[model samples]
Target chain A: MSSSTDTQGTGAYAPALESPRSPYRRGKPTRSNWELHGWLFMRMSGVLLLVMVFGHLWVNMVAGEGINQVDWSFVAGKWSSPFWQTWDLIMLWLAQLHGTNGVRTIINDYAERDATRFWLKMALYTATLVVLVLGTLVIFTFDPCMDPASTLEVCRTGSAG
Target chain B: MATSLTPTAKDGPKRPVGTLYRGREGMWSWVAHRISGVAIFFFLFVHVLDTATVRISPEAYDAVIGQYKNPVMGVGELGLVGAVVFHALNGIRIILVDFWSKGTQHQRKLFWGVVVLFTLMMVPFAIRHLTFVFGH
Candidate 1:
């Protein structure tokens, strides 16, 4: 090691010099935009979610009777419409993916041990899969008239097929 | 003999190092964003499950949703909305920081703007929502 003055507060040891002929030990870089796309997706989906979530809160909680208005009938009424069905389907997908990715980043940051990080991420993926599939199915296969005693106009009049 | 690079008592100031982000507005907002995001994510799982109860029966769905209408859960709902609002507002701030030309320079102002707006919106919402919950 060469004798040198330390500028930053460490001892007088100078920086290590490397041989120009030293072979690069790092593995080849796999060209990918996965992380970049994930970053962009967060920003784009976040903007969309800000609008959609506000609309959702306005419709469900801020309008009419607020939380009291939420019930099975309310769900049936909203899903009965093709527009809300589509709205919710998109929301389900976007929100689930956004939330999953956000949590994955947090897991990466906090879970120091490799095994812990892997298991935690595995659990997160499993739960996300279940919620996404179940939520989508619920929206698609919803039988608004499933209840024989349903008071909905379509259900009561037997117009629903 | 191995030489260590650790600084001695005569090296410099005795103050501790690191924590570059401590006590800064940017740091606090980042912390809040992470926290609120995690909270919202966990809530989403429960929300999806509750909504899925619709597929079971109307009676089943109402039975569960009924729990949220009470005064206690009503207040909890207010907090949840508050968290959502904060997260959403700060998220926009983060976007501006990334995209806007002067965003980094005025980030502190933007954070205060987020705080003010959050308060302005939440006040009316809390009043209206509480009225709905309690007046009924």
Candidate 2:
């Protein structure tokens, strides 16, 4: 109400009046609850991301020999453990979903054209889906001993090398 | 005429402007918050792909992550750390402000607290991370 009355001038930086929180242009009030859900998700995911991401950085780059020690065998060793695998899996899922939703908000706010907004979000979701699927597969399906041509000590054996 | 010219917000005036942040600190903090968020989002894209490389072969995965060992990439890593730290700290501040009863009232003070904590958390980290990269 107040926002509608306040919108009169136009400029490059001009923001739109607050749109009524209803899908129907002039119908009954709707309770999609999506905005609330997204708000809560961002907060929850932020806390989890802090722990997962920092732990990841700390283990991979801070402990032991740091980044230099990270090689095929290093990853193989880590992924061998169920704890690390699940940690990574949760990190991957939460970060992707959280980041995708954030970008989606930006798109909705800035992309004025409906078609542009739709296509851009489509691309974002597509990229996110690809990463999520590929990362999940890589985490769960990885096998250090899968390669025959590999000369690594671990790859020589078939038993959880 | 006086009432009309006064432009009461609910009068459906020709121009409706939503409330915008006026404080300099708040504005800058808001900008940094968004930037850090976007940066993390972009990093996640690459990080996923890089991590996925592990699936190919140990050699492939090792080689991919190894590329980040360089000084240039080290600096980029520092930037990434900065973004992450800022985002996380600021995010906590935001959560407090939104959820805690007294948070919004002292949001300005809380922001400064974030900055102080950020410095404490990240400064030593940046120094160490850089030292690790260059010391090698």
Candidate 3:
């Protein structure tokens, strides 16, 4: 509001190229390595999530007959296989934990009060725990025939259980 | 550095005015990365809840997933794919910048590279995906 200079057009664009100086570079910084671990984990899990998520989408929604073919039995059949179960379980864990950590970073950066940060992260962790438990149970405990109301033909004979 | 900053500072009234996109490509890329990250995060949140229907009866589970087949939801699925692709691609770019010595120097170039790659991957994939959803 104080000025009218249009340096954007008048001067050559000088891109900010240098990386920010590390906090540890200053005098006697007592640094814990937790953030370093988190940073590395993001990259590693990102690589894995890309593969698992894409493959999950491909197999469940894209390959074979695609979405219309996805029924209760389709899911039951998938969970019945240990490989697919593990695939889904890993994907669920990686996505949830990675996302939770990402939001945690945001919360820490912006939340001004200790109580606000504490409560927000507590809520986030609770939701993440609930989802993780639910996803894990769905992947592992799934039994199509065991569901009493299943109308799928595979469940008719009760042998699919 | 202290002496150099003094001459660059214009008088109070003549100072630089705010403009759109004052930040460079890396900052904009960071903004996009967070937006896409949160999109994918919330999608997974809802998706996990939806998948929990598997614990319910088959009738109940089918009732939930059946809506996803609608063309309306197909459009949402496309948006989901867009978020996922951008997040993943930019996630890689960030990884490079963090761990590679040369990556920080070429961060802007890396961002444009990601945008081009995203276009290449999305266009054909989206066309084919939509054909399946609405073609029937």
Off by over 4 Å in 3: A1-31, A147-161, B1-22
Q: Rank the candidates by lDDT, best first.
A: 1, 2, 3
Per-model clash counts, in order, read 0, 10, 0
Per-model C-alpha lDDT, please? 0.89, 0.83, 0.82
Which run of 10 residues does model 3 chain A get worst, by summed lDDT? A1-10
What fraction of native interface contacts does model 1 preserve?
0.85
What's the distance in Å from true for residue B58, model 3?
1.5
Instruction: Write one digit per residue (lDDT tens) for candidate 1, span A29-140.
Output: 6888899999999999999999999999999998988877888888888988999999999988999999999999999999999999999999999999999999999999
Off by over 4 Å in 2: A1-29, A146-161, B1-20
Q: Mind giving the per-residue lDDT tens digits that candidate 3 earns over B78-135?
A: 8888888888888889889888999988888899999999999889778877877898
Better of 2 and 3 by DockQ: 2
- The best candidate in terms of TM-score: 1
Q: List the residue pairs that clash in candidate 2.
A: A5-B12, A6-B15, A6-B16, A7-B14, A7-B15, A7-B16, A8-B14, A8-B15, A8-B16, A9-B15
> Residue-wise lDDT of candidate 1 within B11-82, one digit each (tens)?
664444435355678999999999999989988999999999999888899888987878998898898999
Candidate 1 TM-score over all chains jointly: 0.83
